[model samples]
Target: MTDTDVLVVGGGPVGLGAAVEARRAGLEVVVVEPRAGTIDKACGEGLMPGALRLLQGWDVDPPGRPIAGIRYCSGETAVSHRFVGPAGRGVRRTALHEALRRRAAELGVVTVTGRVDDVEVLTSRGTVRAAGVEARWLLACDGLHSTVRRRLGLDVDPDRPAAADARRGTDDRRRYGLRHHVGVAPWTDLVEVHWTPTAEVYVTPVADDVVGIAVLGPRGTDLDAAVAASPALARRVADAPVVSTTRGAGPLRQRSHRRAAGPVRLVGDASGYVDALTGEGLRVGWAQARAAVATLDDPEAYERAWRAATRDYRVLTAGLVRWATSPARPLVVPVARRAPRVFAGVVERLAR
Candidate 1:
């Protein structure tokens, strides 16, 4: 069996980032992923300023359009808040994946094209084994609905009555996301979030000539219908050619009882995810990756760090998701419009 100091499951952006962090810490890392090429996902594709800074620190800068701020719109009401620090970037998922993959490669991280069906944690020996590879620590970055988490008995059932109450009813109604790209010039520098009664459409400028549209709502949301609900958004992309096949991800809410079990630590979405309502997935995942690698030797410390790192995201995103799915959903835009400073404050907090 191959040997390494750390083994990362899944080769998505967060998995690659975890591998990079381990390599930076002078540890040999191996990443196992079933997918063979650059990985893409159904995401909003807007990296907040904090996330951009983290990638820049790793010298992995992917090309994309600059995102100046965020705009919330519903009917005729609209409100926006520009980031005060470095501008965020709206990058294609594949582009971001390639950049992180390159960085991990440069650091001598090995990638295996396979899946880890079984993981064995040797607590006494301080090692973990999975898929013919042995490592001192195993990082489960496999993402929401992670098999690693489930196998380790860390998965929490959000549908349970107790769990539902703990989540503030965010899981009462499951939501999913669908993303696609269109070959149309972006009309705005800001990421525009158009609110609908049943769903929300995110418009992000990934390239000068391409815009990404993502819809989040109950399962089986029609991407076309969601965009059509927003007249202004519908008109902008009415004649544009669709550039990418639709990618989907779902049951947006996932939970893990804890971040660590024996020698394995769940990083990124594998740990737990509330929702993507605030567009904080990448930023929060990156943070968890860093924390996971930093506290590899101390599972308890890693658990604390993971909780601290995700607290804000868990709180804000869950609260927003609850509000968005509630009966007062239509008031979202108007409330933001009326309370401009409050909206700006929230945006600024998230941007950081």
Candidate 2:
């Protein structure tokens, strides 16, 4: 018999989500990861209402502050939108991971605490000898720069001529994200996104007494400098004490020519990423995880499902990122404030 029906690589939210969902689908699942306890990553920490609903369906509720809406601020201009339905939550990454880990254990998903390297794909199975685990199928949620994608020859070939934009210097620019937690009471249930000339600072309350600040900007952008650029956010956290060391996620972009190759499948950031401007990473990723396992019987179905699941995010995020980086970047907040109805509609649509 195969060691497991589905072996999930990476134990972050996406990996864990896949493992749990696979087990729920009545498959024997095993997760291979190097980390043991709750895993944390640099993230905005805001779960959109739709994301919360998705997690709830899996019965994986983690403690956190309730988020009612979203707010955009730049200089003296500001725009806000409140969800028409249930509010979202802002759970810490560690908390979210631990909750899912516990649920996975309860559901009998085994965990092998070891890293997977040099994956070998056999005719009917995928094997990671370093971890000595083999499964009929593999779901690589290994993250932004997936090792599996590279080992499988799915990554963009560096030797290949760069894309047109890269040749034109546009692709040379890359964005990264940094996050830290501070001890303080949140001022609003709405997630406040402070847009600056060079960065976007996201203020998300993860607990009754703590808030997380995530900054996204060009490479080498300083977190402190970014925070200081946002007046409203600076004032709010001026007196708050830092509670967590800073963490980061890079390039904010990844690529995968295809979703599946042989027995290995890429999910979450491993599959590909656009940008986090809309704060819908978790929602899109969770959807992909579910779709990944649900379509195991027909791997090609995953490509269609993945595209459908990420359609909104890909379109909206790409459009917004382009606008944010263009010469009209300075007009973002002002235009949002000028067109309240339109801005609210976009925010609500993305929040879903």
Which candidate tops TM-score?
1
TM-score of 1: 0.97
In model 2, the clashing pairs are: none
lDDT of 1 by residue, 23-42 (tens): 99899999999999998889
Give the distance in Å from residue 219's predicted Cα in candidate 2 to where it truly belongs: 0.7
lDDT tens per residue, model 2, 221-304: 888899999877898899899999999988877777899877778999899888988898889888999998888877789999
- Top of the candidates by lDDT: 1
The CA lDDT at 212 in model 1 is 98
Candidate 2 lDDT (Cα, 0 to 1): 0.87
- C-alpha TM-score for every candidate: 0.97, 0.96
Q: Model 1: which residue pairs collide?
A: none
Query: Model 2 Cα displacement at 39 (Å)?
Result: 1.2
lDDT score, residue 207, model 1? 98
CA lDDT, candidate 2, residue 234: 90
